[model samples]
Target: MKLREIAHSRTGDKGNISNISLIAYDMNDYEKLKQAVTAEKVKAYFSDIVKGDVVRYELPNIGALNFVMYSALGGGVTRTLAHDMHGKGLSAALMNMDI
Candidate 1:
């Protein structure tokens, strides 16, 4: 399913990179989601599509997951098209992940 299917996103722009803050909703079922999502899990969730790295930041207080995926936007603003960069296709790709 898409990230939107499981969690809500707070998207922000920074230089060429985008920061996507994720909070799992009731739709994800906390216990199941806790077991399902992790740093390694998030990385695996994005392994193929992401070219650079996926950094995970856990928020215990909020019970949420944040991943800062880099170099996925065709070099962000540095690219010729200067495309959407900040992970243009990420939402769809992340949503497709099984877990």
Candidate 2:
């Protein structure tokens, strides 16, 4: 599945880091999404494609998940360590999940 097919992304740039926040369009999709996408799981999701650190924060109040992908070109060059292509970045990346 593509990310545009599942969720919408709200993106922000804070200095050298980029913050990508994801929310479900259909509220009913929350549980399914939560199960499929997790903090640890997200780390794996972006592990190969992203370098530095991948931090996942769960917001229970909003029933949403936020991903802080460090050194993944928020406002800087791509990570020098990993060669994986997280093409299109987070916004397009999440939509591409099989879920």
Candidate 3:
């Protein structure tokens, strides 16, 4: 099962840092996401692009997981020559993860 089936993601970027928020559509699926999704997994999944550490913050009250990835934007939007400088596609890529 793909993560997208149960949740959706939103991404934000600042400097070389990228933050992805995974929010479950149904509250019941939150636990399942928590069990399967981890900072390590996310870090590994985006290893090619992310150059630093991945940190996950659980927001049980909102049934969401927030991942902070460092050194992920090449060198931030202002400096990176990549087409998707904002790293928004990363959220969609993360949705492809198996749950």
Candidate 4:
């Protein structure tokens, strides 16, 4: 099943960094999300775009996972000529991943 089936995501950006938070729709599914969504997988998923590192922070208490991707904004909002400079679409792209 796709990760979006069980969770939703929110994204934010700062300079060249992008932060995405995936929150489980049902708390019970948090564990499954944890096991399936790793820093390595996320980094690989966005390999072409994220030029730096992907760090995963587990928010078990909130039934969520936060991914901090470095160098993901093509040099921040002002510098990047990309359409999605803020990388908001990245959250949607990640949601398409199979869990």
Candidate 5:
């Protein structure tokens, strides 16, 4: 199953970094998410776009996982010629990950 089936995501950006938060639809699935989604996996998944380190922060109390992707915004929104400068579509792209 895709991650989207069990969780939803929100995206934010600052300079060349992208912050993606994945929240489980049900608290019971939080464990599954933690086990399946890792910083290494996310870095590999977005290898084409993410040029720096990927860090994962667990939010067990909120049933969510936050990923901080460095050098992901093509040198920030103002300078990037990329269509999705704000990296909004990144959340949607992440949702497609297989769980």
Candidate 6:
């Protein structure tokens, strides 16, 4: 199953960083997500776009995970020639991850 089946994501971008919050639909799925979603996996998944490290922050109480991706905005919104300067599509891209 893909992560989208169990969770949804929100994306934000600032400078060259992209932040994505993955929130599970149910607490029951949190454990599965925690085990399956890792910084390394995310980094590899977006390797072509993200140029720097990926960091994951756990939010057990909320059944959510926040991923901070560095150097992902093509050198920031104002400077980048990338189509999606805000990286909004990133959330949908993440949902494509197999879980």
Q: TM-scores for all candidates? A: 0.65, 0.67, 0.95, 0.96, 0.96, 0.95
Q: Kindly give the stretch of ten consecutive residues in candidate 1 with the minimal lDDT sum.
A: 80-89
After superposition, the stretches of candidate 5 with alpha carbons farther than 4 Å from their true spots are: none
Model 1, range 1-99, lDDT digits (tens) per residue? 544666665665454455566677763354555576665776676665456666767765675767777765555656627444455456545556676
Candidate 2: TM-score?
0.67
| lDDT (tens digit, per residue) of candidate 6 on 4-71 | 99999888988899999999999999999999999999999999999999999999999999999999
Cα RMSD (Å) per model? 3.2, 4.2, 0.9, 0.8, 0.8, 0.9
| Alpha-carbon shift of residue 21 in model 4 (angstroms) | 0.3
lDDT of 4 by residue, 1-99 (tens): 999999999899989999999999999999999999999999999998999999999999999999999999899888998887675789999999998
lDDT at position 26, candidate 3: 98
Poorest stretch of ten by lDDT in candidate 3: 81-90
Assess candidate 5 and give its TM-score to the true structure.
Answer: 0.96
lDDT value, candidate 4, whole model: 0.93
* Pairs in clash, predicted candidate 5: none
Error of 2 at 78 (Å): 10
Taking the tens digit of each residue's C-alpha lDDT, what string does model 5 give over 1-99? 999999999899999999999999999999999999999999999999999999999999999999999999889988899898575789899999998
C-alpha RMSD of candidate 1:
3.2
- Error at 47, model 1, angstroms: 3.7
Q: CA lDDT of each candidate?
A: 0.60, 0.63, 0.93, 0.93, 0.93, 0.92
Q: By TM-score, highest first, what's the ranking?
A: 5, 4, 6, 3, 2, 1
Q: TM-score: which is higher, 1 or 6? A: 6
lDDT of 2 by residue, 1-99 (tens): 655555677776444455677787777766766787765666677665455676777766665678887766533535434332233355666666666
Q: Would you list the clashing residue pairs of candidate 6? A: none
